[model samples]
Target: MDQTVSTVIDEDVCIGCGMCVKVCPVGTISMKEGRAAVTGKWSLNCGHCEAVCPVDAVRVMSLDKEQSAFGTFDADHRWLPHGEYDTVQLVRLMSSRRSCRNFKDEPVDRPLLEDLVKIGVTAPSGTNSQRWSFTILPTRHAVIGLAEKVGGFYLRLNRLAEKSWLRFLLRMVGKRDLEDYYHTYYEYVEEGLMEWKQKGRDRLFHGAHAAIVLGSKPGATLPKEDALLAAQNMLLAAHAMGLGTCLIGMAVEAMKRDRSIARFLGIPDKEQTFAIIALGLPDEEYQSTAGRKLVVPRYFEG
Candidate 1:
């Protein structure tokens, strides 16, 4: 973790109220001679001090200000305090964001995709590593190109699963992955592949005009979780932007099982992909929010 302090406090603007010192997670800022100063050697560069400052005197050089600026919409730069947002509308948006399988033939603009990536990075990361990477397939042609690669991978996998002797041999060595995949997904994948090849139907991406592949570079403390959190942000933001989104887990699995797929997508060897989001203008609509299965909450008194 690169924790070298990039925080600088303007003495003239700082009121020395000690809020920055109080909120510094790594103790990077401390009150010295009645004025807050950057006395620590290391910091998380999370901009907590900057956000908490009453006088806007603190600045985190490692953080990018342009990330908050959006091209598609005007963003409110002022921070919203806790419990200030409308919870009903928030829940409504969450409930309305379903996995869309039907997308229009229209293509998504590059600026919207770029703005979505910006929304993604707003998610919290472990230790503020912020190592997440986004690879955008901005056009239908690019999306189809990646989909073909994923479909090919599944085609090869189906072939291996078709070999009963190979499945048994792998199971004999205490590896049941092949057998389990054969039992669980063989038939479904076979149908999808058939639809893709014979009918030219896109079962992989569901005819989405654009896609975003989310990944994390090496050395992230919690890469998968970080990527997933960012993915959820993108999903919700996409829905709000009048676009439909679906998570293509099969594509993620393909990249995980076959490194060549990632290489084909121009991702580096060390970077690990966590999610693939297929998105475009929706061709389908619903009347109401769907219901979820009920679950009981548990309390941990300890």
Candidate 2:
């Protein structure tokens, strides 16, 4: 292999968990002394291996590239009556949001995350109950721990379905795969279930810089509409921060069923966990589209 193009795995940092080995696209890496050991000239084709090393053991040559994408958007020019530019800016923010699932390995900063949470508080709640709470889940270790427990439960249920004649019947009804996802489907439910499940969760929460679990008391004075409104506010604030968010559904559903997860979250039995979201800087880019069609419910427009 060319010394100019090389890879290094920090033995002390690596868990020797073999995730990267399974995820390697070219299959050039293996574990040695419970740590990742690169082998074969295929190691020469080892770019993918460096992408998902959760522990940062695998050093990629390009990881050091500077990322300074902050506050690049501008729209101060007035284009309409009243707060024209600012109104346009509001439209812009909404259109920019996407269900992001890709994220970098860097941990989200706590202070920044709190700022995002403050924006969440602005959302309206029924009768001012404001019954919403946000919990941030960071770190691969915590994600893996959650995935293992949840994934085990799902895998076991799936196996039970397979053993029964119902497995054959489910195909007809649309209960495809029976399991939540075949492999690497849910970072919190699927650890190494994908064909390359062993590789790593380089993209958990879609690599979002942070994660949020938003919920409200089961029967709080706040209306159900309040909960949803609050989540939308949080989402917009994250997007404006140059952060992408994936509104997680299935994984949170599993947590709802599993009291153990709720316990970890520290929610009292009286409260219910609602919308969950993952936050981070977006890796992929696309042009923006605005929902400015002006669909007024025309009450007899003269």
TM-score for all models, in order of appearance: 0.98, 0.57
TM-score, predicted candidate 2 vs. hidden true structure: 0.57
User: Can you write out model 1's per-residue Cα lDDT over 218-265, one digit (the tens) per residue?
Assistant: 878999999999999999999999999999999999999999999998
Q: Which candidate is the best by lDDT?
A: 1
Error of 1 at 148 (Å): 1.0
Those runs of model 1 whose alpha carbons end farther than 4 Å from true positions after fitting are none
Shift of residue 218 alpha carbon in model 1, Å = 1.5
Residue-pair clashes per candidate:
0, 13
| CA lDDT for candidate 1 | 0.94
Give the worst 10-residue stretch by lDDT in candidate 1.
Answer: 1-10
Mark the regions of model 2 whose C-alpha exceeds 4 Å error after superposition.
1-85, 164-192, 201-204, 290-302
